[model samples]
Target: MEKNIQTKYWVVDGKEPDPGIIRQAGEIIRNGGLVAFPTETVYGLGASALDDNAVEGIFRAKGRPQDNPLIVHVADMDRVWELVSGVPARAAGLMEKFWPGPLTVILRDGGVAAKKVTAGLDTLALRMPDHPVALALIRAAGVPVAAPSANLSGRPSPTTAEHVRNDLSGRLDAILDGGPAGLGVESTVVDLSGETPVLLRPGGITPGQIESVTGRILLDPSLEPGAVIPGKPRSPGMKYRHYAPAAPLVLVEGTPSRVTGIVRQMLEENLLRGKRVGVLCREENAGLYPGAAVVGAGAGGEPGETASKLYAALRRLDQLGVDLILAEGVEPRGVGLAVANRLRRAAGKIINTGQLHE
Candidate 1:
């Protein structure tokens, strides 16, 4: 049964929200309502994982597929065992090192998580988010919250509370405005239920980082482009269309100069057709395309800066209402790998000028 949920929007001061308001949001979740809250990686649209109806609200609100499955989030490490039958040795190591951070692991469900939350799959994806606001809500609600990126399904993930309101204001119950997300990406999802540990999706954590601790880890082929059908994703972002924007985006891949040249060429071609173009590239290359609206991918010197600035840049382009978006690909290493992955998906066409294949 659906309850009459009055949409409430609150703008709280500082990193910590008011205890009274946080409790109010928690009660909403307890009563089978949706709430968007900030996590370290990104804001997640949350519902009680144990409540089938509450979990269903998330899918309806986001227009997400039921079979796509959801990530159950907990506040503490000890709370993990309640969701999953048992954690693998490698998964345990990862959780110990990365839990209370942006890592989600697939485990055999303990039968407590709602069928809707897992999409009736025996295994459930679980994580302990590394954000103060997220942790407080879970602790207050006293229930494991199953959540996905707090944006419309297949669109760019929301990095700030305002982004959540823009995409999902009237559709949900409330949004916890805890400022912008830190990592500005989703959690790294690893499937540990199978014999070999596999990375289902890449996000804030990189494959190299996970490999160091667990030895060799396998990358899920589903994460590759054109590998899986839409709505059948084993994990979030495995589907072909994800993290996209309203404007048609084309990704230019190669060295910075090569990418700049290709973007300039594409910008000119679009302009010849009288199309308004936007260029998303590094700060150094912004001047390459004079007529186009140029936005920096991130500051050149700062590490992980590109990943941090990616979604915000895309959102800005949408605000400008550009007809075409020409995004420059970043280096495919460290957090840059995650940034590049999102750009690849966001782009409708990818022109690879590089000699090496990804």
Candidate 2:
């Protein structure tokens, strides 16, 4: 846990990762060392899933809570069978439809992975990342990799290797740079450890897409807007305040005009109070905020665009050293639901104009 740990940094091609560099990074994981690697969604700090000491190192390096479980990434279905007790019919179907993508499924533990990977829980979360670097590293490591967001816990997830180095340079064994992550959010997590599939957390995958596979899935009550997880979270980003930047953030939700108007008003008020205010909005509204620092998540306020740019925008505002941030929320449907969920958690306060007419 010393601050002087020597970290290796390597750059790999996103399309065709260099096998030599991947092998070196894989060896680190095989030897119970931590490595931060890129996935389609975000960069993940990984360790050998079967190594207890290595898994413990991840929590220590990131200062993450031990109770918060980590997602185990596998290169193939064979590894999936090695980690989970069984894959239900629905879970198997989901894997068929969404594997090699940003979807994490929770299943019963098979007692094969490190105890810490499951956080003493009877269930384990597993994913097959779509990124080439991720799969190459996992395959080379020869073990399921237990990983979480590469950045320090509670911070905006890293979308670029530079972001990872900023937060975890001295704390990790190695960092495999694969350029910027595509989705810029975590995987969609669905829990199938029970009779029905439960949406634990929304992410790159839409609920409608999942529903198309499994008839009707239930949403975790904790995911309800304004609802707090009272106890240990069943998934990452559920229990704690995560994706927060250094400055306090306020989320504004309503019609697009209403959200923009309210954020502008707040921006002026904060500026008048001698505060360095930052506005996080769609590219179309970027010109609306004149004096305040403005960062756009995406153009046209599209959910997919917003989701892919949200974390990076938050990190950029942090670098600007703003005293406060006002973020415009997207609609709670499709990938927009995931975008709004992250914004709500990041915001210290939220303003929802109950007017449903968009």
Candidate 3:
């Protein structure tokens, strides 16, 4: 199959996505062409999940591995069971609570329709995206769309349409210009395939939130390096190094004073080794490492705003050709947990200085 190589970008505002642009995007997907659009979580490069050839195009466009499955975005709950053979009772409970939001439920026997989307896994990751543009495109196209983050595989996920164009301009068929992604991170992935529900990946929704709704204890996988399981993966974010940047990253976690100290030490060490260093922190911490180039999204204590800027900050820092990025970890509460989870994945090493500061 020759690759669908028509590289066209249709910029449309989310406030009022032009009907013509929406129709065009829908047509592209209907005809087996790849369309990149914004979800609340991130911009997803999507293809028709029902079409084997269309799913293959997504793998080629993103340079994603076949084993790393894609999430199927649906317009409504009724459409979900069409993709999955049998939706579990626990999954139904979660759907009632968290659907049309950030939660993605992985279900068993997702049928042949889902097999193409999940890379032949017995399980399928399904989400009802809250973004207007995402829901509009899925409804317009009239098919379950299998989408992954719209960036090179394993690179930082795109949270804006411009980021999508930057990473996939020549590689994609069309880009629907939605505004900035509200969540600025991927969806919270939960596995309901087993007798006990498990939280595969943390995101806008937390395990506590899921437990509150389902009255079940959700387990986080006790993952170790190089540990491979036998059957299909229950969660999407497991078994991969995701949201990485070009430059190496170091996570600085602790109180303000201790984190600052660690950042200074890292900068001094990098300077001694003749390497340029960049820090992803708030403006107040700029003075901590005077010689380093500091990038601040805003003042501290607003994790929602921090989450919005996280991916863009990483992309910008990566583009500057810095040798290393020292990022400050936010308090893990509310949206902060999602922000911290992404930072942990982006950082190559974590420096926990909680005790040192005390």
Candidate 4:
């Protein structure tokens, strides 16, 4: 993989992407090569969805599992149906409202996607990203692009172009540097192959919003702590533990005050043991941990801010060389639920503030 490394790195103005540069990345995808480009959510490792060999390169580049599946990004509804058997009525409504945004829908297989893209299942996940560079590449390639987060399989998902470089610099044919992603998290993945739509993953689009558009949607049981996901997962974030950082992490969940107390106690205890600890908390809670390296999750009480800063905060803590990270969990409501989900998976352990500290 190292021998064929290209010097083709390109940067877009974010306002007006260079058509020529985007076409270059598109050609790579068209010819079965990998390109990492920024999306509104996170940077994505993209390949032509219709090309079996190209899509396989995406799994290999990210060290992603074949059975885990990948989301196909398109430029429009026509491209969407070209890859799926047909979009369900509910899915069509979602696409109408959320296409060109951060939502991925899984529909019945049309057999147009590579077998490996769907993990040989009868369904494939699809989305149309709202990022300029991403859309440009997809349109230039003139084929649906299948992408996973542009990071190593289990590591923190890359939200900036630098993060992608840090993880996949030499592996891809080119990387479109379009500044930091807007969402800083992955898309909401909803499975629509069944009678009632099931939310396979909580993301930028909340369950409440989906319910409003498609009526009541079911939540996969595996989304809860200690519940096993039944059968093969039809969505990307369902199959594995992900968004982990290098240092061991523990999630602290409770009311703001209780969370602060728990984090304060843990930081002190770990500091007494001479462990260099990092606290990922909100701006107001920074003063609680006097001796630990503190990385802010968000400002005010806005979970959108926290969701945007979550991965970057984890990466910053890692850069500070902390031995352990103790994070204050966001409330399990709205986009906050998705933020909490990523934090819990990133953490090897979870501590409810009401529980006694070990």
The best candidate by TM-score is 2
**Which 10-residue window in model 2 sums to the lowest lDDT?**
349-358
Which is the better candidate, 1 or 4, if ranked by TM-score? 4
Q: Write the per-residue lDDT of candidate 1 for residues 1-358, one digit (tens) a residue.
A: 2334566887664367799989998998888888999888888999998999888888888888677889999988777887789988999999888888888899898998898987767898989988888988998888999999999888889989889988888878998888888888788898889888898878888888898778888987775644645455667777647899899999887776777778888899999999989999888778889889888877654437877778888999998989999988777667776777788778898888984233
Candidate 2 shows a clash count of: 0
**Model 2 misplaced regions, further than 4 Å:** none
lDDT of 2 by residue, 1-358 (tens): 6778799999999989999999999999999999999999999999999999999999999899989999999999998888888989999999999999999999999999999998888999999999999999999999999999999889999999999999998999999999999988899999999998999999989999998998899999878767878767778889888899999999888888788889889888888899999999889889999888999988754789988899999999999999999998788888888888898888899998765237
Residue lDDT tens for model 3, 27-52: 88988889999888899998988898
Model 3: which ten-residue window has the lowest total lDDT? Answer: 221-230
Q: Please list the Cα RMSD from the true structure of every candidate, rounded to 1 decimal place.
A: 2.3, 1.1, 2.6, 2.3
Q: Select the stronger candidate by TM-score from 1 and 2.
A: 2
Give the better candidate number (2 or 4) by lDDT.
Answer: 2
Q: For each candidate, how many residue pairs have backbone atoms clashing (under 3 Å)? A: 0, 0, 0, 0
Superior candidate under lDDT, 2 versus 3: 2
Work out how many backbone clashes candidate 4 has.
0
The full ranking of all candidates by lDDT, starting with the best, is: 2, 4, 1, 3
| Candidate 4 CA-lDDT value | 0.86
For candidate 1, which ten residues in a row score worst on lDDT?
223-232
Q: TM-scores of the models, in the given order? A: 0.94, 0.98, 0.92, 0.96
